[model samples]
Target: MMLDRKGNNPLLAIKFFGEGIRWLGNSKLRKFVVIPVLVNLVLYAVAFALGYLYLGDMIDRLIPDWLQWLRWILWPLFFIGFFIGGFFTFTVLANLIASPFYGMLSAATLGIAAGESATVMEVPWLRVVKAELRRAAYLGVRAILLVIISIIPGINVIAPLLWALFGAWGMALEYLAYPLENAGILFSEQRKLIGSVRWGALSFGGLAAAGLAVPIVNIVVAPAAVIGATLYLREIEKK
Candidate 1:
């Protein structure tokens, strides 16, 4: 579980995620991953169903009559863009709804990672809710700004790339927040900690973003990312 503190190996993040997948098989952790997976499953299923039904209508409205000629080119791009946007958006919603379970999951993972008995620590409910709310507010404002940038002509040419990077960074913050908060790290400190290991955090979050973009694979990515972030925090603290 030891990592080179001074090394800049971003692949280590992927390795950590792999370790998370392996840990999901551990009996003690199975219960923790199940609820989140089910929650994500239902939410994502509903989202995909809605998208399937309304995506064409949405495109039609957005593209205009004169732009119908570009429908062939724009359809796939819009689909992909919506998919990625939905993935990150719903991910934040799912995490907020399941924050309590995730708090316990992070604690259990950290305890086990430290070779201690896996026990859930007593965190104040209000504190947990407030912390999650802070993260949501932070994400919400930035998302609004990103949406504005996305619609701007010419400037929006790089919107996809911007969203991709933002999504990766957001994922890193989302999962890492659990373990970091459990250890009494404030949101500001959490960002600083992740920023300290910028490449690795982005890699972990990017790999997570990619995995969660896939259908069935995404069901498990949320919990696995939680475990991976816990392990990531443990290693980072060693520095």
Candidate 2:
């Protein structure tokens, strides 16, 4: 499990993510991935179902009759937005609900990555919940700000790019939290650690976000992300 830490290669994150998928096949790590995958499957299925049912109505409401011609252009953008938004939103909720399991998964992955036995660590449910709440609040406030910017006059033009970056950064923070917390790193410090390797972290998160946008692929991406984040942190610590 020795990771390649040669240079500050942004694509290294992607390799770690792939390593995560490969690690899922490891018998020792297989058990740790199950619950998170199931949680993702259920949450995403429901979210996609609801989105499918209401997406048409939402699009109609957003575009007036005079702008009917714009539907052809805006429809795709709206669909992409809905997909990314729904994925990130449900991802946060899923991670919150499954935080305890994720904690154990991260610990076990760390153990395996270190060439040790896969030991399930005890999860402090209360603390994990509180941490998740803090992260949610942090993300929520920023998300609201982004939404406001999205609706502003000229400044709104770059909103989509902003959201894309935010989503990538958010995904990095979301997955990286488990291992960082297990290592006794606080939320504030975790941000700094991620910031230190911003591009690599974002690459990992961006690819993860992209993978989760797919249908069946999204189901396993959560657990894979957990493993990937663990690997990413391990490499960061080595540096």
Candidate 3:
């Protein structure tokens, strides 16, 4: 059941979306959806509040004397803090919303590794939180390293692109890790599973990530993408 490692399977992208739609039917979408939206609202509020508290004074002091006249130029940088804060907050929240479904998806994805039919079942919140925290800690460290790289003058120009890449990979890993664990695979085994089909996972994940970047649209898209990622794992196993 180990997937073919040599090529990308484009059809999986379509299947991913279709499966996502199907998975959404399992829920009272209104009930599941409301929590994520509220989580998002809380995230935004926290982001804004932190920005005003921390950045407001920092920007005032940090704005150079000569650049004081160009306060507008420094304005956007102040908001970067908000985005950074929101990024981690959203990841935690998205995983929380999708947690109930993750075990079912994981069962399918990991069943391939186990050479068996995986039962679809509900995942407990504690399990989801534990799994996500493990993966998130790894990605958070990598993101910090990427931030350091961006501080370098010559490299800073490509920082945006690098961060985007990291974000995409992080999302894919986060999504995949849940299912892999449910199937009783450890982190190392899950890494191997994904490593074999990295391109397909990354490309499909990047597409799903488009939803994460949007505002209101992201609320629906986030859980959908997790489902998509789950389906993506199932399809990849067939290859």
Candidate 4:
């Protein structure tokens, strides 16, 4: 079912998000989620290990001996910090590496949504890898630009709000990229289309950004986003 009639409705975003999760319950889609999850897990493991082995020592040394009791709060605080950092750092990195899988995953989802047999054709593995690498490079460049923007002097103050807005926008774009690209939609066209239902897209993307901040659930964001964005796209198409 489609969400409410209102284009600006954040609640509609939530409903669409729910449909995405339900879409994932299909056994077929579960296979598409595996490699992405593995990539997430491996990166999280390495990050956590480094954080504990090195960063933990630095934090411990920063604390005074007289305030040993502070360990109670400090450890949990460190973990939270790691989690926040990981959510931002790792999700992009993992997704970048797994972009090809996500493209195929998105294609499969689109096929299923249309009630068709699989539309994906057997292509050469090298071609798939090259396309994914290009996508990863594009995203990496965009990420570097965002990082530069975040570090600027005066802009740094409002940089956080900018980051959230950009992150939400990026989340929306990444998922929608699949079907849109397939349909030959350019980035400019996608932006115009999104503007037509601005708030709904933002709400949907903002929530997707939130999902990345959480643990476990963030692992399958690729597939889930495919579902959510597909549903959201259909809504836009109907209008």
Off by over 4 Å in 2: 1-8, 50-82
Q: Could you tell me the lDDT of residue 45 within candidate 3?
A: 68
Candidates in descending TM-score order: 2, 1, 4, 3
Tell me the whole-model lDDT of each prediction, alpha carbons only.
Answer: 0.82, 0.83, 0.64, 0.71
Query: Tens digit of lDDT per residue, candidate 2, span 107-185?
Result: 9999988889888778679999999999889888999999999999999999999988988888888898899889888
lDDT assessment of candidate 1? 0.82
Which candidate gets the maximum TM-score versus the true structure?
Answer: 2
Candidate 4 residue 58 Cα shift, in angstroms, is: 2.8
Please tell me which model should have the higher lDDT, number 3 or number 4: 4
lDDT of 1 by residue, 115-168 (tens): 898899877888877888888888778888989999999999999998888888
- The C-alpha TM-scores of every prediction are 0.82, 0.83, 0.70, 0.75
Instruction: Give all candidate RMSDs, comma-separated.
Output: 4.2, 4.4, 5.3, 4.5
Expressed as tens digits, the lDDT of each residue in 58-79 for candidate 4 is: 7678878898788788788878
Task: Give the lowest summed-lDDT range of ten residues in model 2.
Answer: 1-10
Ranking by lDDT: 2, 1, 4, 3
Please write out the lDDT profile of model 3 over residues 42-144, one tens digit for every residue: 7666757776877668867878778776667556766664555556676566576556555554454344334665445566667767776777778879988
Question: What lDDT is reached at residue 33 by model 4?
Answer: 71
**TM-score between model 4 and native:** 0.75
Count of steric clashes across candidates, in order: 0, 0, 2, 0
Model 2 global lDDT (CA atoms, 0 to 1): 0.83
Candidate 1: segments with Cα more than 4 A from true spot: 1-8, 50-82
Score candidate 1 by TM-score against the native: 0.82
